[model samples]
Target: MSAKNRDNKNRWRNITVGFRVSPEENELINRAVALSGLPKQEYCYRRCLNQDVVVQGNPRVYKALKTEFATVLAELKRIEAGKGVDDELLSVIELISIILGGLKGEDANGE
Candidate 1:
């Protein structure tokens, strides 16, 4: 058998939890996970438990931020003529803002 896995608290993580999400929801979750620089499972559990997903600045996170910024710029260009923005895009923007704010030693409310 493969080696067992344990969390930081030394508890065995033997339980298997699964759920289904629509394509759009999956995309959002994946994006959030990438931005948070946390493993998908950890991110999901933290979010489910209403715990904070503290972001630490690292190369992976920096790359994700760069990629997301490019995407947002493209979408903004496409919608430059006062077009309605997709809610998903707005959500991404909000997430990026929060991450950036934290990196700058600011809170979610920019304080």
Candidate 2:
């Protein structure tokens, strides 16, 4: 489907759905909504429809982890090239460094 079509499909929603629940169930629903960081209506709607609601972490942390994985793949490539695996195998220590650097509030440009 085209992006325009998808946008049009999402442009309007008119149906209203309601249900009764105990106080404990209400509290649990509210907690789930809070953790999802989505509005209560959206969270509840998605949940009722069995849609996956992903809770994403900090983008910087995600990028840092991606870089760490790439670094590991590169190290493996080196080992596959008949290079001696020395302390270089411990280079994954840099993964922590990358994660820390990203968590320090730096943007993608490190600015």
Candidate 3:
């Protein structure tokens, strides 16, 4: 067998998911991950590993939701530019997350 095949057989079999996107989308995704202070692949891997994440959704709808989330986060920053996390704001964030988490499909359950 090939060295590549031997290596593949020895490694853990993580399921693969692929994407097809234009260069612009790739750049945007890279920027987003960088802004989060994580390497691009690490960001993707952590997101994939996190069972609490909403596993499946309509891509466009998910993108729209994420866009709106960024907008809300920006609004919070403007409101508290030099301040730390406010208790009320943190609670709101948690509530929003819980609502969003409910929108996911079930394949991710108990992961």
Candidate 4:
């Protein structure tokens, strides 16, 4: 698809912008977002806007955790810029969520 065509489908288009990074940074960025399995543009857009693309949160804890995740995810954004987290962090987050009675390996919204 053309860049212009793709742009039409991006619901967050109002907030997203694109730019190029160095080849080394590009390689790293691609690798990171691949791990999270979210598209790079979407991930970058959310990070730039400081919003959670995945709105999984416990209503009771969500406001807090989502904020925390947004922050952490933002840090992850800096580390990888919409790429993804280390497996260790992913495991830890999931384990904590499961232990806290959230369904492991699934959307918090039950999707």
Candidate 5:
């Protein structure tokens, strides 16, 4: 048998939770997870609990940000070509802005 899982508070985490989402939602969640530099489970747990998902700067997160910037650039070019902006793209931009803002704040505080 595998070892039991416990949360930071030492609470046993045995219950399983499951949900379904559309492809668009899945893509958004995956992007957020990647950008947060946290495991998918931790990200979802924090989000569900309405707790802050603090992002720590690391190679994985930096790579995710770079890839996301490329996606945003392509989307902006499409918009310039007369295509309307999609909600998913806007959501991604908002997430990126939040992450960057937090990082900026950290830098200002020399953390």
Candidate 6:
């Protein structure tokens, strides 16, 4: 390899950083890394650098919940159009609306 290319490749990631952790802290760190769905080193590097880490939910569960809200949405539309909806159904639908909004990562007030 040319001297410049060799130097460039070597300099890309030449730093090594590490610290000791207690058993409890190690377990917690492992759990966090797993939850992040990233490799342990990458998770630690991102966290240490204070980068925003977005932990998304399981795709299957998210999709399932969204699908479940479809029925509630239809009911809500019916209620909005002057159809009689029971008090219990209305309450449940309201709650579901809140939950669906939250799942979409919006604030309770839809901000």
lDDT (10s digit) by residue, model 1, range 1-111: 557799989999888889999999998999999999999999999999999999999999999999999999999988996877999999999999999999989965678
Sorting all predicted structures by lDDT, with the top scorer first, yields: 1, 5, 6, 2, 3, 4
Better of 3 and 5 by TM-score: 5
As for candidate 1, its clashing pairs are none
* Least accurate 10 contiguous residues by lDDT in model 5: 102-111
The lDDT of each candidate is 0.93, 0.59, 0.53, 0.53, 0.93, 0.62
How many clashes show up per model?
A: 0, 0, 0, 3, 0, 0
Model 3 C-alpha lDDT per residue in residues 16-49, reported as the tens digit of each score:
5687889966755654453344445556767777
Strongest candidate by TM-score: 1
- TM values, all candidates: 0.92, 0.43, 0.29, 0.35, 0.91, 0.43
lDDT (tens digit, per residue) of candidate 4 on 1-111: 333433545543343356979996675555444433457776676667797645334453444445446655666667675565666556545634543354244556654
Model 1: residues with Cα > 4 Å off, grouped in runs: none
Model 5 TM-score is 0.91
Better of 4 and 6 by lDDT: 6
lDDT of 1 at 53: 95
Candidate 1 TM-score versus the reference: 0.92
Ranking of models by TM-score? 1, 5, 6, 2, 4, 3
> Candidate 6: which pairs clash?
none
Residue 60's lDDT within candidate 3 is 49
Query: In terms of lDDT, which candidate is strongest?
Result: 1
lDDT of 5 by residue, 56-89 (tens): 9899999999999999999999999999998989
